[model samples]
Target: MEQRHKDLLRENRVFLIDNLIMKNFIDHVAELLTANMEDTIMSNATNHEQVGCFLNILERRGKGAYQKFIEALTDAECDHVRSHLEQLEDEDCVDGYDDIDGPIRQETGNDDVDLHVSDWMKTDLSEEQRQTPISERAMAFVAREAVGVMEVGKLMGFTEGRLRQFQASSPIPSSQISTMFSAWRSQKGKQATVENFVRLMRDAEVDEQHLKNVITREYPPGDAMA
Candidate 1:
């Protein structure tokens, strides 16, 4: 089996059985598959091969088949799923995770200054929130605050020019950025630099909570999604 399939099995084993919310998500996916298959048999059949790869992993876990999987769900399980789904849906609506309908915050403005490090530290933001992409201004600030763009890029195993391109056009992966940050900070007598870097990130509106979490070596909640 593919590593991705193995990972799915591992995640499903950990989350899907005991977690009603996950179970409901799987059920919803199954429902969507059924509906799509009803509409276009051949298309859905092709898709089913991909899904079948996932289901086969579950079957290996002693679930037998999809119908049996549905039959196995208890009333209490269904109730818990519905309750959790409703709560999540409500939160999603308020947060606009699906569709953010607002003006993008400018790089240098009062809006940028609004999200202070102290305010972020007080709230229990999820890993997803912390992992949100850093802005170019924030990346530039971090690069400046650290040893330098070239040094930081070397630490990240990327060329200085490539790192600059990433800062200008895209955010580096949070884990990679975090790892490089930590490694850069670990050099002897760099504690003050690290502190200054954190402040610079806060000033740049770079979601300093994640920087704090990384500097403190806090383990990600759950398995550090992506």
Candidate 2:
């Protein structure tokens, strides 16, 4: 989760610093955070600094926290960054953005920038290996690696109708994955082991061998069944 946080901070710092990180967006994030961001950061920081500070705090919270922060940004009409995440694709070079090209930005005037917003998802375990029974990290990994609603649902034994409900209720795959994991754990009870969940992921073709390693070997002060 730390790396994802860093990448998001980097992305926002690079592209969003001037564009999305403004007073209106920061204020909206603060409102959404309620008490999460504390009074001091909200009251005493610049828009950019506040965002960094909030994310720094969230880095210790969990992926869900960062997700909510992104949602708050969306609520504030920062949809430009949202779309980049929505369809993890290489968008057409944003014609004429010249600043710091390669991975973050381009020069300007006559320059172009390629936006592969999917880069933040390169790492599987972004947070310190937590011992949550439901394995928040695993769910988040699947949410990032898995594709398509019905495909994942069917592979995990969710009926099309029920999967539709997840799609309806959760705006993003991360939330949908969490909701589905809740449903899965609720239904499966103590049977929802890390191995079982990993099976579902493999069946759905998420291809997370590294995550498998983490779950089976390195990560297990807690797995879903622990």
Candidate 3:
């Protein structure tokens, strides 16, 4: 998307989120935008997170998609969003970025995200809001809300053999998930972040329901969405 569009989306994100939550607009708008969002992503995500996904998808789909998206918003009586898109600056950005929108987003518009650890698991998210290594509070929220220990471990960079090894060794473990998290944190070192962790999970081709539940984590009340 143009930087103007990105800025528009960034500024009016809260209103659009509310609009999506209150109305039957998600599927309709997704159809218009050609995003084809998964059931898990739609069902388990919060209104705020859903809008994030929506905006990201819209941006990713680029020119062909944004017109449909804007038209849909206009149809939905989403004045805040419609007005912003319609009134965007004629000048386009060379790099096409918005400073406030630089967080490591959880939702993705890519294809074929694989599992297993890699140096590619670099983490740089929400520096505009929080640090990359995930603040303790954010980690706590992820650790608490997280389900599906084994899959999450894979997203966190664990291999199938290693998970089985742990299971075999610990036989009747009290908290396999917590233990997995500790290992992930230790391995990721400074890169262990809520954005990286959640994005990696959702970005995977698995499309597990767990990823949706993840980015919905509550940070401080009255965040940008609130």
Candidate 4:
């Protein structure tokens, strides 16, 4: 009788440990799916492929365990999971479901540069928008508007010839322009106004005079010009 009692206790302990492990595994999978869902949805892409890959990994790791894990959840919990997945799928459709292009930008009349930058930063940009090189005209306009070309050139460590070349070139590689912008921003004490103008010029269409006026108003003759 004592031997039988010992055996039953051992069995109970094993069952408890197994239950604990299964609960942990299920929680981990849920967390992963939730994170993937958020990332995919926010970036305006479907998570089907990622979710499928995750499930495949779970199945490969332990098919029986995966099945048991699914069975362990209550019907309501399962429904909740399915609902979230379906909602994300629907959102992807509404978001245009293009990973390469991202969500389409809706044109709005509000051209307030600060507000524009704030809104623009909230969404993912298209590949072309991110990859396309900055035109020299655009760079020149930004420099001429925000800070003088001489100051930009000095901050960017450009030689006189290089500065002249940059002014003359039509499209400078985007990477170089990014470096210049970073340098300019750092030198300007990380001013949001300067950062906003650079981001606006790089990401959106703007009139030269309008941008110039915005910058001129923010930094009068002696402030940034000096």
Candidate 5:
């Protein structure tokens, strides 16, 4: 199989099985590796053959193949597999696997980690809440509005691209984008307007094409249905 397919299989295996199942699979792989460990790594040709054989074994075993393989292995062999998996998990954690969410986040509206809401909120008040100028408030509010749009986009199955596109075209100024988004959201069941969106982006000096790309990621293109 292609490397991409192999990668996909690994991901599927990891996500579909819980810790116990994973342990069983690891045990099986360990047993296979141990049987040929002496020569498996010493010779590249043997390593390829062994890998193919291992994959064959796994395929024939089906969903519980790993567990079954483990059941047949000696206790010592099983320990080796367990140790390997522990090491893999530790490596994955230390490598910052959690940061992968930077591409597509689950918390669209809330910037807890990815969006950083605390920083955005700072713009909410000026020297004395004198209601900083509508222009600046409007710009600050864009972040809030973007949050809501992002949340809605996520609910609708939109991507990052689509969300940015919608934000770009809103008639609301960047300063008041948040309020505009809030107003649109309060409308209940009605989708946000796009005509006004175009007007706003034009005012903000945002590139129309660039916004389209952003929205493409956040929502679906051509159709904002997400």
Candidate 6:
């Protein structure tokens, strides 16, 4: 009887562990899909063939095939996938699944500067909008305005061909962008207003006298700028 009980416990543990791992994988994929679709919907040209190409590269790189699949998913698909996976995970937990490999991990592999914007902007992007790296996030801002590569390049003071090359190389994953946008929506940046700054300075008891003293000491006679 004891042996039977031990075997049953072992089976339960295996089941729980598998389910938990599956849940984490699904969540990671969802984020990938979100980032990919932050701007343009996946084109008809981007069928399974392109996805397969990415999967092949990822598998070769040992980054996980499932993750590449998620990155290839469309914005619309990601929303559904995220919901379904979340539901499945919740059900497993309710049924006593508790063996997570770790707390959720964020996807942070791709860092090509060209992919900074569209890669961080697209569908339902609350999280990306909030936590996207500044450089990447800035691109999305310009892209949303429909600023073409040439226009953006001009703004950045780069040549058009160079900008296009950058854009081509750093193709943004819609899933990642979507998740970032979700985060973005719920967050607010610090308002760099005069009133707010003054309020903060006052709260800290900083006044013109403090500023003048620091400036005078730092400048020291002829070193002061006009």
The model with the greatest TM-score is: 2
Residue 46's lDDT within candidate 1 is 41
Clashes of 6: 34
Model 3 lDDT tens row, 51-129: 6676655554323355677677767777675675455533223344333222223243123233322212222113332
- Candidate 4: global Cα-lDDT? 0.38
RMSD of 3: 14.1
Runs with alpha carbons beyond 4 Å of true place in candidate 3: 32-36, 88-226
- Please provide TM-scores, in order, for all candidate models, with all chains considered together: 0.22, 0.37, 0.35, 0.21, 0.20, 0.19
Worst 10 residues of 1 by lDDT: 58-67
lDDT tens digits, residue span 1-226, model 4: 1222222223334332333333223444442222333344334232344433333333222113323333444432554543443455456556555332232222333354346444433332332332333333444444422322333455445677766554455343333444465444454442423444445453322333445444444434433211
Of the two candidates 2 and 5, the one with more favorable lDDT, higher being better, is 2
List, residue by residue over 14-40, the lDDT tens digit for candidate 2. 555456555566566542232424564
Cα displacement (angstroms), candidate 4, residue 156, comes to 2.1
Stretches off by above 4 angstroms in model 1 are 1-114, 118-179, 186-194, 199-226
Candidate 4: where is the Cα deviation over 4 Å? 1-125, 160-226
Error in Å for residue 185 of model 6 = 38
Candidate 1: clashing pairs of residues: none
* Pick by TM-score: 4 or 6, better one: 4
Give lDDT tens digits, candidate 5, residues 1-226.
2222233336545322322333333444442332233233334354344444444334322223344444544453445545554455456557553343322344453354313322322332222221122222233323321323444344434567756776677644332345444444444223333323323433332333343334333333332221
lDDT of each: 0.40, 0.53, 0.49, 0.38, 0.38, 0.32
lDDT of 6 by residue, 1-226 (tens): 1222222323344332332333223344443222323222233244333333322222212113233443433332455443444455556556554333111211333343223232322222333222333332332342322212332234334465555555565445322222332233333233322222222222222223332233234323443233
> What's model 3's overall lDDT?
0.49
Candidate 1 C-alpha lDDT tens digits along 1-226: 2223233344455334355343223444342222323233333344434344334433322112333444434433565544443455456556643332212323344555445554543354454434443333344333322322333445345667665654554233333444445443443232324334555444332324445656334423443465
Clash total of candidate 1: 0
- lDDT of model 1 at residue 30? 40
